[model samples]
Target: MEQQPTADPRGAIETVFRIESPRIIAGVTRIVRDVGIAEELAQDALVAALEQWPRDGVPDNPGAWLMATAKHRAIDLVRRRERYARKLEEVGRDLSLSTPHHVDEPADPDAIDDDLLRLVFTACHPVLSAEARIALTLRLLGGLTTPEIARAYLAPEPTIAQRIVRAKRTLATRGVAFEVPYGPEREARLGSVLEVIYLIFNEGYAATAGDDLLRPALCEDALRLARVLAELMPKESEVHGLVALLELQSSRAAARTGPSGEPVLLKDQNRSRWNRLLIRRGFAALARANAVSTGVPGPYALQAAIAACHAQAYAYEDTDWHQIATLYGLLVTRSPSPVIELNRAVAVSMADGPEPALAIVDTLATEPALRDYHLLPSVRGDLLARLGRTAEARAEFERAALLARNARERALLEERAVGLDRPAAEGPAGTAAVRCGRAGPRSGGQ
Candidate 1:
């Protein structure tokens, strides 16, 4: 057993686990032939390292060490079962009980790609249901813990845990192969997988709960996964679309939160904070998506265009709201929803005036979908404020504040309501950038 190095072995273990766990699990599943059992074996390997590495010093190749440890567990699992001989035969090995416990097999790194892709496909299989596939894939492939998955979805830990359990059982019982789909079946399954990845990124970019507005870890993880998938499936235009959308959205993460972690509205945030490199990459990906087909823009590619408009503008005042409004119009027709319509109304408000936007929002007031959505009222309130309907705007602000779950968002809305009755605090046009009771977007990078 090798020991971890002097530089905090636990920290080293944690980092290595995050980077290497997926590969280890994928590799181990090949030897054990059961993803559920393979995960158990991989966990055992991690436990072994936590105990042995501190005393023996880190191995030159930590990943290889972990892989080897996991292999030992697989061997033990096979040997302990009455079906050991049968399993050995299945693996194309000698079934003699007297034979050495160590399995005979050549290391094949190139085969890892097929195995990993298979694992992803299996985890994202339609058989497991959308939410189940997402939770299972994130747990196994995204290097995310069950708790992490629970937190990401705003679900209880036990609920996430149960979903994972059932998902894996369903895969095992159905004998789902760890392989990519081909033809129409492939196209359909791939779409579901892409949707999962998109949802993961969206949740991270705007967390549903907790005090913090963003979870960069989830966003980065999703981006990394999408980028890898894009490379693995280069011929698919939508893969590139998803990758492009994520990278572009992630670029704005730095600008989304203020010094004290308050939300920053799009038009008010500092454009200088956006990552230029990501913007260029997004544009290139969008171009590739466009060149791939003459079909109407897919959801991701269309959304990328919207993001591009914001990314290109050097300043808030210079933004082309009219083009954005037009794009949103196209988006609503192509993919109609209250969310898109609400967003379009915002653009309309900026392009036309509060009156038209209010009318659009008012139409949605009877919509069951937007009935509980705080953003609807928030948008309505902003439009009303712009229209000089102080009394209604103030009421709407208070309603939005009550509807919001995030403390920071609720506080911001409350402040807006309070300000309606009071004078604006001394500052620039962009409301006071409150921190932990402080002010402004901290350029100091707090």
Candidate 2:
């Protein structure tokens, strides 16, 4: 009698792929010295697993099984090439002569981590454009299919496919190294890595140009990467800070949308819906960040401090806006970005009143960067409404609606705009407008 496969081996395969694709790709890249080829070999392993795992029982260590299978595929690929002799010599010397073989033993844990770190640095290399780095990193590390990434970012499927293909080719053509940098080089590359992760988290927290209000999967992916990076580089304070900011912000995910998937302002959200566990994690990460810092806070740490203020408040009214404003002031002095100033203005409004914040918003009205920023007008509109200038507030709200890219956000702005014309009981004037800076004219789901 023949042996039977598991009841849902196909499902099991997909689950394993999502969990272990990064490791497989990382390990194979160490073998083949090419990310594109490594990914191809990893996929081949998946195909083999799909064909064989159902017939044979799933392996106890499926990740290790995938890695071994990818290694074999890589070896076959090398042998099939016309330059097999030269390539084998190169691999023999580069990999310390430990040639791969069909064995059930797991690869060295330290080597796996090294490979993963190399893949991370390679995917986020400054040689590639920021957009390319993000798309490729998500595909390689997030284990997201081309279609899945496209759907998440509201991009056409073919565009994302081309982006990933071009990114890999660019890396190969440029002969980018497959290893982490040290000292100055490491610090420089670190910024790009952090930016990539930040972009991912922001896109998930607030969809840039999608009909959906939020994409929790992207947020989860970014958070997982941040946690991994924090573990990989424990001495890096900004990494922990980024993790803290993400955790604190993500705790509000449950309360960020309504039944119809409409945007829910932070003040209007039900505090009970916030995730307590995430809040606790955010606090721990914030503490770790502070512990690792050298007295001066970094960009991520300052932002995390701002988020912490909100997380610590049990109610909207209980929020310590004064402290938040102080933190944002420090952030402004350090980062000196118009966006930071805009956010600080919001904090000022909460701590002081609409008058002072409105003055600050007016100063930024002519700022080239904030000219198209929807949040600027949104904040201005809220201040105008509070100051009894209903007509001006209506105009600002309409302008914000015109600038908003996300359908949900546009609808929210429109709602706020139209409500001003209604009676006091039906108007949104009592509540401040939600200051949203993450969404705008930028493409690819912001």
Candidate 3:
């Protein structure tokens, strides 16, 4: 083993691991026929790399190196198992023969993509719970470790680990094929796939419980997956819609946090810091979504349009609230989520007045879904503040701060509650941008 001269080879090892883990896992799963075992082999390769890279100085083509290494491990493991003959027959002779020479038989682009798409569909299989689907997809398709997935979503590590374990067991027990579904089956599973990716991006955009406001790495992972899905299904308007939504929302990454890493509300963020490149990409994606659409806009397309409304507004006051409200109205018909209604209420507040919006929020106050959701009270507090009901607004803000999980958001909510000394509704207009009660359309990058 050649020793690496670099001071920090471990960092390079980690970077390589994150980038190539998904591909390695996908490729190995084809041979192993078990996602869990495939992942173990991939991790084994990473461990080998960590041990050797610092001595061998990272390989010229690290990804290919890792794949070759993982394939060899898979072959060895199967040979040791009692069902070696059955496994060899399943993977066929080509894989077995290539393993001996370490010839690095990286498949063609189309085949590789097919493997990845299969992995995505398998991880997002409807047989798994929604939480399980998200966890498994993040683990298998996003190259995220169980602990990393747990941290990103603010769930307990053991809980996430169990979810991943159970999800893989479920797929195996149900005899879920490691191939993309076709026809109606494909369409049926597509929603869950898109949803898992969306949930990942939302967590990155607005962390649920972390000290930090945003996790850029998670955002990058989600965006990359969305773009891949778009290429894989060019005719799918909703795929394009999802890409558009993520692009538009990500455009504000720079402006979303203050110098001290405090949460910068959309209404208060500096427009100049918004990434123009991402915004343009978002517009192009939205155009593609529209061009491909046959009838009503999909859920993601509608949400993208709403985000576009915010992106195009050079100033918060210039935003077309009425158009947004109309879009929300349309979205409600299509999605009909309480979270959507909360978002619509925000638009209604901006378009009409806080009175009607307050009515809507009051109705949602008792909603089971919104009970532990801090944003519900946060939005209600903002509305109350605007309505000159300082005492009620203060209480709501305090309650919101108590329920909020993220440190930055909790601090912001506490600050708002403490600042109730001023006469109600005396701040600049648009001070309280309508935040969705939960993660849904019209959220500020969430």
Candidate 4:
């Protein structure tokens, strides 16, 4: 089937390319064996579509059309490099480039899935720095332009461009394979992939530097990538767990900020604003993760379980703090870090009391990892306020505000500190105290 010709196909071309670029790049990379070149060929295919689609009409399967066009360009590149014969033998019977008519054939779904998985692993390879991996992942898999990514993270456009360029150069120079790894290597690389996605979502959920508290586009990209990974590797429990965690966290996006974009603490947020659909999807994904698990739940699954506890509670007072505390305790054993411990302390405060939780926080005060972490002082301030140590609480809040990088969070912390001096009836009530519990475990590298 062919779409009827339109007066101008540019709009259609742009829309289709944005949706299909990742698949096109992945498919082309399968032939070119270089992601950077694969991206260039995908862009070339888009150029071809812009030049020809208006005259010929948009194809019925625009995605397949773009994929085929990019693959053809990739084949031509390989031929010019004198590697056509070797590449033909390398790809073997799967090589569909022998005839031009093959472009009309729909690509194999299984092959496309494998290629996308390969592209994911390639983009998040360990050879590149974390920032580079994130920049490249957003560019290649998220289909985000350099400026979009730069705006999302509040980095200079040229800096992000340099990071992407350096990342691809590093991946190629290091000879990193495009295929997914196996056994121990697979387990390790899988963590890297999950970490990258988690970091992206965290940055969006609670931006570190920008005036905005939530960058919805970054969150959407991370969620989309997680969902795709869940489909591509259905058997991986942590993958599903990652999907679940992100879905549940995203459900609260609507309620996380006030009318004027101020940070809303968990206790004060309107639960009615939560996205029930995302919560249900999160629950389903969590069930899938649990169903496929052979041993103990992974870090992400445990965190999702904690989030589920909050989702189940209609009111802040109804939340199952004990269950959340138990899950965080288990998470600590699996993925021990100062951050997890701090999160666990928050849950413990809710379930037990502030006194014991403060003891936990005090012990962690000496840990170098938490020294610069603003949340540590933020949590400590909350605990101190709960225990009626108003002056100390105000000091801690001031310190946290000073340490915070995000303007919104800094303002919230400053308000908390100032509110401590107000009369009991006028003071900010439970808002600041429940911030940590509602925010969930910052385990994904906040």
TM-scores, all candidates, are 0.70, 0.69, 0.76, 0.67
lDDT of each: 0.69, 0.74, 0.77, 0.77
lDDT of candidate 1 over 1-446, digit per residue (tens): 33335655887776677667767788777666677888888888888878866776666666667776786667678888766676666654311222212223334545655566667777887788887888887777666678666644546779899999999898888887766777777777887678666765665666545577776765765676677777767777778877777777777888888899987766577878889999898888878877775688876777677777767779777677788788878877876777677777777777787789789989989987456566667777777777778899888889978876667778778888888767643212222221100010111011
Per-residue CA lDDT of model 4 for 90-205, tens digit only, reads 76666565333235666776676677667878887878887788789778866767875764444688999999999989888888888877666766678768876775676667
Regions of candidate 1 where Cα sits further than 4 Å from its true position:
1-119, 129-166, 181-185, 422-446
Residue 270 displacement in candidate 2 (angstroms): 1.5
Model 1: worst 10 consecutive residues (lDDT sum) = 436-445
Native-vs-model 3 lDDT? 0.77
User: Could you tell me the lDDT of residue 87 within candidate 3?
Assistant: 78
Q: Report how far residue 424 has shifted in candidate 3, in Å.
A: 6.5
Evaluate model 2: give its lDDT.
Answer: 0.74
The CA root-mean-square deviation of candidate 3, after full C-alpha superposition on the true structure, stands at 5.3
* True-structure lDDT of candidate 1: 0.69
TM-score of model 1 (CA atoms)? 0.70
C-alpha displacement of 260 in model 3, angstroms? Answer: 2.7
Error of 2 at 353 (Å): 1.2
- Candidate 2, 152: how far from true, in Å? 14
- lDDT at 365, model 4: 91
